[model samples]
Target: MAKEKLNYIHIIVTVYVLQLGVDMFRMSNMLAEDFGTNGWIAILIVSIFVVGIIYTIGLVYRLGEGKSIFEILENHLPKFMLYPFYLGVAVLWTLIGTFIGKHYIFVLQMLSFPTTSQSIFNGMLIFLAIILFSMGIYNMVKAATIFFFFTVWTIFVVAFYLPEFEFIRLTTHFFSGGDGYIKGFYRVFVTFFGFELVLLLFPYMQKNTPVFKATLIGHLLLTSAYVIASIVCFGVFSLYQLKYLLVPGLELLSYIELPFVERVESLIFNLFIGEVIVSIGFYFWGAQEMLIRLFRKHSKAKKAKKLTLALIAGIFVYSMQFDTLIQVHEMLHKLSLFHTAVIFGLPIVLLSLLFWEKRKEKKSNAKSI
Candidate 1:
């Protein structure tokens, strides 16, 4: 049976919501701290590489030939050989989702509710993610699409800061240093990392939809928005100032003085809650889907989803103990190597193997004919 599939807009929303959360919340500051004046350069370089990765993922999606990647791989490869890769993806996204939830809860604690217990927020969020995942892909993507318009106006708020921006602040040396640039690149790479969701999500997209074009267009939009926000932050703050701030984009928002509002950033932060939910929801969904593949072989769908949700929520709550924001950043920095190997390297290797196998299979059929 043909599975229900998402249109291009849903795909775009899925990608958009996936990338917008922790990345948009804190990435500009990380870039500024690492590359200083050359932050934008680091972003541009990484974005080009990420776009190529997305394009390749779209190609791999077609190789699924109407099945999910898990189904395709399971049908063709030995279970022992394929299950580890599936487990790696499941673990990677689960950890990423956990960290994002923890980080945002910590941020909220820092900004608004110092007296509130983070464990409460963490539990609530994981519970919320599980409920959303149970609703299935179409509802999740629909949620992403609706939340986007609620948050879209915040992009234009960057414009309000333009008059205060001193273009000379952007005049620092282009190459801060090769070493520093590389460090900046790695930090920014984490921000750009979520687009690879397309690999896992391919089968869910409508068969007739232009997955490549939709992902590319969606990425272009995401990239442009982040670049503009990063540049705006760079232009508004000196290197010394930018390096110390936790969320420079929020700082940009703090400057706005509306007739009725006292702090525009506070309002913006609340609006961003929807984005955070959608982003984390996608990861939880990805993790749950991978679990179904590993434990259920895609059968017993209802039972698998329930078990996956409980396992994820339990892990998320347990991991939130005594985790400070600095600790979270340091932990993510150390985990980058593992992330690169599993999330980035494994896909490329798998794509090559799939292409080779398909070509050989085609040749074999031609010979038989």
Candidate 2:
């Protein structure tokens, strides 16, 4: 069977959905607690850093033009280096799955399933992610696009409760401290970490499409969403009140009383399960792609599919062995820097080298001619 071609819009939508995962809704609360009243300013500063990240990510995509990141690395780097790079990415994705799964469990406990075991909840999510990963990228992207719209509609429906927003309380001391704001800015920058997956998705896009435009629009949408969420959390709950909350966005909904529904927050929490599942599915697909490119020589789709299932099963088993969620989160946080380096940093270096080598080759050919 011929491989299906994905256009730029599909790639862009997949990237956007991956980035807007479960984290965005609660990231502001983490930033506010970390940076206090200066969180918004920190978010603004982080947005600037995101521009740099965006440029670097664009370079990675450019380097892998017409090829996936795995293929590009396999062609450019030696086998030894390539294997290590692939391993790093696979480990990073697995760690991400674990981290997100833990958070999902935390959210579930806080909202509805307080009696459930965290391990059981996490195991179930990991199992589901494994199933999704068994499906290839094309299917994953289709599912993501559908979920993306669902999440957007939910966001809008949830926004109607914004009338309960207490602006003065939220803005009581906006931008009071320069130092704290700077620290908060860095935290917000880290929150947008999932955009790095574009490295894997870019090559699958149709040639000559303006990927950067789609990405820019996506980032702007994400920023606006974050800002709105921050305002809602701040306006609805006092700083002291918010500090104790695990997921402030859901808590914000809990305070709202809709005539039609008494437990609107519960509904939003359920929707969030879908959002996180899609997000994890995308990451799992990326990890499988990287692994397949590194270890297998088979170009046949059926063989690749079988290999992907085996790998996901292995990852699921490994995910269950971690004794505690805190250990998993710590490993994820530390490993994320390596992911930043490979997904963002290595691409810039590779692209520069590729460009210089091409220019030199061109000059030599011109002289010879």
Report lDDT per candidate.
0.75, 0.67
Query: Which of the numbered candidates is closest to the native, going by highest lDDT?
Result: 1
lDDT of model 2, residue 231: 63
lDDT of 2 by residue, 271-312 (tens): 667667777877777777766665476556465456556665
lDDT of 1 by residue, 306-350 (tens): 766676866676676646888877766665677777666755766
lDDT (C-alpha) at residue 250 in model 1:
79
**Which parts of model 1 have CA positions greater than 4 angstroms off?**
1-4, 177-179
TM-score of each candidate structure, all chains considered together:
0.92, 0.86
Q: Residue 107 in candidate 2 has what lDDT?
A: 65
Model 2 worst lDDT window (10 residues): 175-184
